[model samples]
Target: MRYLFLLFMLFTFQLNAQVVADDFEGFGTIYSWYGDDCIVDANFLNPYQQGINVSNTVLEYHDIGGQYANVQFDIDTTYDLTMNNSFSLNVYVPSSGLTGSEINQISLKLQDKNIEFPWMTQSEIVKPIVLDQWQTITFDFENDFYINLDSNSLPPIERTDFNRVVIQVNGENNDDEVLAYLDDVLYFDTVSNNPIYDNLVWFDEFDGNGPVDASKWFKQTQLIAGDSWANGELQHYTNRQDNSFLDNGSLKIVAKGETYNDQDVTKDYTSARLNSKFAFQYGRVEVRAKLPSIAGTWPAIWLLGKNINEDGGYWDAAGFGNTSWPLCGEIDIMEPNVAKNQILATWHWDNGSGYQINSNSVPSTNANTSQNWHIYTLEWSEDTMKIYMDDTLVNQMDSVNPFNQEYYILLNVAMGGSLGGDIQPGFNQDAMEIDYVRVYQETPLSVQHFEKNKVSFYPNPVQNKLHIDTHQFANTNTKVQITDLSGRIISKKQYAENGDTLIYNTSALNVGVYFMTLSFDNGINQTFKFIKQ
Candidate 1:
């Protein structure tokens, strides 16, 4: 009977995939929709959005009258929540979006269609959205499946047969003035609609190398032109084997405190900077590296516009002929401050007026960034740039400025600069070790396909439930288990040996970290760690 129920659930799930119920594309003017306390703001320009999409009319919530005042709207189409159970929408929250002393969180009221009156269940979003940016708010019904009711006369809210979506901005029973912007409401299946990026434009494992690959990478010495690398940097870059080398499938850039004179330019510290010969316009990049522990060591994995040769990565006796920096865009992927547990992503460009630097920094409150290996990622398209560390979104930005041009990769370590401050006198030598650097472009699948395409799960610090899907797991015994860090089993489930998709509920677990493992009959086991916050 358990297997039978699982089979039926999978069957029903496969039948109800995601279709665009309503995009709110032409909501007020061309199309018809009903909303209270909100109207289409046609003239207001949206500074941030997807690349292909322009600043269209967004449903704006004006001065939401008073405490508990809200702008409510409903999607009139019938949606089968059993399959397409996630409701996603984009909300623009200005710096002053949340006004007055109100406990954070907005309430989403979903109603089921009924003959007389629909059954309403309200869910509160406790996760606060970042301000002064456009954020896609996704509500997975399976995660926080709580139903807050004022009157208990109606039966429990049903999840399998829901057809309507009613949302109240700032509706967690809190009273306050709220102003917000809403757009692109969608219902989607988390697994079937999984996005993939498979094109491997460039990658360097740095394995079996004496010197860095000259065809793909070149060393940048500050003495190439003059050692005037900006930001009060204190490092003399060298292309010698003492500064950079590969061993055991890892590239190490050693930073030494005592440096000798070279080509009339001398510094107390010597390090290495390698710039890529390959330049790409738009793509996703992932770099796995363990950082240096010494104080005042600024290890960076970054990019610069190939056209801008100010730093002189590939300079000749004639020098690179380009305009200059600020005319050329710069994207800082991972720049971990010296001796700090924080990382920052910065964008520098000239906006036809003046130079601007927009940096988004995220700090680790628990541990130092130099403690272990981490995967730093940057997803860049035409107009959008998002950064992540170990799959946690550091921040996102939207702009089509000078960053629209092609940029090449750069890796280096600088000591005692603006961000890297206070070098310890006793510091001698430390190295930033890198495992691999992989660059991928938009495609139909993921780069993980290079590993035979194992099971995939997403939204890694999973909020409530973990969705797992495997394309090739055939008629074999399969069991997935969730366990704590101490190897204690929290929950386990045995699925039918044939299906490619399954789910594990983590809502009932504690608010700590846990591990999930998938066991197959072919003696293969895959385990991944996730947080249930």
Candidate 2:
């Protein structure tokens, strides 16, 4: 028994030590590939311009807006991707002209040639995508790949029989004929037990005195012109610090029961509502706030689309009803009804009926643990909203619907209204204390390359021709936009590619200081100042 255990340990170590590398360094010798509506040749390019021989020839997919284009690899032997825990890929996608729908529009799949058609494991491209430059996309097989089997009399596509690998563009993006490329596909066996997001794009620490950072937040103080801000809420939101202010290192939204007037209306309650100046469509949001324990207090951390058209014109001058409530979706991350001891996570949309909402309610905390600091989180991705309290998932909503669009964050406190309940006699002022609000965007691409190759643009104070040497293949994404010092775009030009050098003519330009921004397919943009004298 002791020798058996020792042998097993040795076998496990040997398995984990194995690594795979298929860089496609050779030209169709040991391994080969093919494309369908996609042309998979690195040598043949349309219109025939000089092409660069990148250290390595990547898998080129010339997708001409067809049903789809896929790359099938010739694996010498059966491949088992599940055996390895992680893999890395080099990919590029042009950022310009891409809609929110095209963000995660890349995917991977595999098939066992021994089985019939569709006998494969294809995963949804849930991974994040950055555009216009080269970036490494890492996949943790334990989470990114799997095979779902259905009823079949024949044996399913066993993991050991997956002899063909397919790389595809998730046929959803509206790209006319994008020239996509892939390089250095490598695999490893270490399973990562960490979160996918490692980048912080925006956040509010709520630190110091005075008003909140104007660059990060904006307070909403106006009442809806003809109507109050929906719900029978009694709070007259104000822009004053008395209602919303920074106390110590936290934010305080005080709900007071007193007569106050704002925007041609009077109310018996006054509070504050703040909106983030920036809007985001997807990411992780975490807010640590202490709810008001006062019987009449209601606090909420939520979001709403920025375009909630409320200018009285049903349409734009000509009258067509552009947009309004519900069409502009609302996401209520957490609304703690102190009086009811329940937390509500509701999603509201407009299907022509003022509002249509789906909600879930859960105990804010254990009876004894009430009125304490709790971490409320909203893990929002492309099409899902997962609400959590202190790390426990309380509610989840599917269907992206309105959430697929960009929306801004809002924090507010209300008193003695619909959900706030009856106010106790002599209700003074109670506050919702917020430790911090942090927003993290999806990033952390797979194993990245640290090559120091510089993509140069020259003719600093040019009069006519400008030259650029991009060590990458020149696709439709290779272009430059020249903007004036005042930030107005002067002209945008596509480069004439010849090997690794791209030539742009700036001969017809006014003489002045200008900025030239070079954009690529893999989320890379380089800007340089130039003089057009």
Tens-digit lDDT track for model 1 on 1-533?
11111100111112124444333333221133445444445334545543212334456655454434454444455555555556656677666756666534445556655534553343333334555666555665543323444344222224444445555665534445566776655544443222245588799998986888778788887553455467887888888898899978989998898866876877798899998877887788999998887778888998877777564456321254374777787888888765476788887888586786767666754545666788999888664677888866665555458888778899888888887788879779888888999998866344344234355665444556666667546676678787553445778887765676666777798655455767777676665445454
Per-residue CA lDDT of model 2 for 226-252, tens digit only, reads 547656676788878788888788888
Number of the top candidate by TM-score? 1
Say what the RMSD of model 1 is.
16.2
Residue 177 in candidate 1 has what lDDT?
A: 59
In candidate 1, stretches whose alpha carbon ends up further than 4 angstroms from where it belongs are 1-196, 223-227, 315-321, 363-368, 442-533
Clash totals in order:
1, 11
Q: After aligning candidate 1 to the native by TM-score, how far in Å is the CA of 20 from where it should be?
A: 13
Native-to-model Cα distance after best TM-score fit, residue 50 in candidate 2, in Å: 49
